[model samples]
Target: MCACPAQKLCTCSASSLKKTSNHRKQKRLFRKAFFFLQRLTRGNQTDTFRGLLLKSTCSFMKNSIFSLILLFSAALTGFAQDTIVLNNGDVLSGEILEQTASHVYFKSAAFGSISINPRDIAEIRFTQDQLGEITVPKDAIAKNEAKPPNLPASKKPEKAAAKPPQKDTSKKTKKKKQWSGQAGLAIALRNKTTSNLSGVYKDEKYETYRLYGNLNWKGERNSLRWDWTYRYSEDEYKIRDDFFNITQKYNRSFKNKNLYATAKTLYQRDYNRRIENEYLQTAELGIKWFGKDSRVKLSTSAGGGYHIYDRLDSSRSNKTSVSLPKFIFDENFSWKILSAQELEIIQKYTHLGNLDDYHLVFSFGVQNKLVRELFLRVEYKIDKDTEVFYDDKGYYDKALLTSLVYKF
Candidate 1:
């Protein structure tokens, strides 16, 4: 500040003054360059060096912007690519060209264009834009097409315009009334020989014959059943045991099909048991624990009814008639051990209120098929009664029977 160069200038050393002068010159050069560029662009003459540089710069910028736009468009299209997933865990990115009831046409960058069965594709993913106008057929997306080798000619797919409405033919076949029956016969012979003064004389000769039959008519919700059995035996040409029984039953099933109501009537005669003639009428409710087609079946019934019995008193040499209120319980069980063999067990209990007596009958049998409709049956039965009479030898009676049966 000893001697200022000017009013607003400050005195400095020689090196500082040289640096300030260099800075001033740089500023002047910058200002001159900026002005020269501005004047060159504002002029109308484009053939000069400045005009050519400006044109080149503008072209470069335009090319860079177009390149960016192209890259963005490519990225968007790649993100929107469709996908096809196959059943065998194959994934393919593609565009769907067309779809029909049985096949799909697709185009892919890697695999080119190809036609494939819709059955082979497990899933498909489409772009949002493609989904709006997709034309895939409903059946094509729903059901798998049958394979070519085993496919029927009638099932071949036609053109989309010729497609027909699908028809459902899956209704079950209606059942009709069915009838089944069985018949059987049995014969037995016995002989007694005594070795006395007369050598090997036939003392007793007797024969037994038995006939049995069963019939059933089955409908949708009801069934009718009939059973008949007859037995005759002679000892020394004199009738020894004569018995017959006939039963008729009508069964009506409930909505559950396993529960039912039954009306039954029975007529019977047994000379050995001293029952001359008996009649029973009853109404019962029954339940089946298993289906009819099951290998094992069990059914139980309980009812009360009136029974009229004509009894023969051998000691008194007279016949008596009695009417009683009876309570009855029945259980029937059958098991099919094989296709051709079956086992059956039947049990019945009867309680007589008037006589204050109870009766039980049980039968066990095995049936084996011998031919198409013929079977061999072996059965053992036991009958027991609480009532004792003069001719009632024991409290229980037992019998064994073998018969040949025919079924229809």
Candidate 2:
């Protein structure tokens, strides 16, 4: 069969069309030959016409059969995205180098690993996990329960095959490969009539709240985290404030795993009545412990830094209390009630010499599929002293919010 270069284009990819085109061209040739045979028999005797038609039919069928074999061969060659299964129930998508009764050799496109035994494997499969330019199919998780080859059906007996060598399962038991990541984005709004931060509270119920997002990138061993939070309220003036933070984190679940810690820095910009600019710098070292239970997880960070408060320039009291950074402790926890919902709590303690106060952050949220590619989040947050606002009197703030999020 003659091949066409441009025929490679398809509704999905260019590869499949080339194979289909070759099959279709053979079909067209078969149809043409059959029609020609019928035309030749139009002016012939009964015997001659029957023989001619029979001969043409056989020839076309032969060509069709050959075409099918070619099509199947082309479909299987040089285009296989095989999945490799591990003993600990882990799977990797890649190309297969060898498939035998005992083991399978594979080479990963993203992460590299070597020979794998199918005995400890649950299954193996091939799929279209790879799609567009640098994008893989989200639903490309395929599984095959194909069992090992059985003994021949022949009555004659043959020599048994030798088994392959085993690897160090002890070391494998000590370490496990993990797939971990977290990412989220949110926006919120609030309104207060007319409120005062300090010195006799008034009615200022106009405020807007927005939390940009946090992106977590997981590497082979470590992870990088970037996150920010922002809230803005408008009374007679345009007031906007934001809090930004970045962290480089490490996590491990195995006993022999390395230390899990994080180094983070945060900045805040607030425009309120009493204090305008509040800035803080912190460096913390902490450890995290989690399991597949997902019911409970805890993380604690303790360190020291400097926080500036309004230059301590209060003219009201000559005995003003300055906001000096002494020590800080942060505690965070997450409880997964269900597969789609979670309960989280955050607490931060600020020890500023004499004026020490703690702010509590707690929320109850459920991650549910609102619609196609859409998610709904409803959370209620209350602070014992929500007065984190500029010049907020020693009081906490409370609010409830709902959000609709879109994802790609």
lDDT of 1 at 206: 51
Q: Clash pairs of candidate 1?
A: none
lDDT of 1 by residue, 1-408 (tens): 445456345444666989999999999999999999889887765568778999999999999999999999788768877787876789888677665556677777887777678656767777744434555544324345654332222233332354686877787878563999999997644332212223223344455689999999998898999999998765443536677999999999999999999988999987655686799998889999999788888888888888898876554268889887788877888777775454443333444333457777777878788878888877766666655343233345566667899999
lDDT of 1 at 29: 100
The true-structure Cα RMSD of candidate 2 reads 35.2
What's the C-alpha lDDT at position 107 in model 2?
65
Candidate 2 lDDT: 0.52
Question: At residue 260, what lDDT does model 1 achieve?
Answer: 94
Alpha-carbon shift of residue 95 in model 1 (angstroms):
24
Residue 274 of model 1, lDDT score: 67
Model number with the top TM-score:
1
lDDT of each: 0.72, 0.52
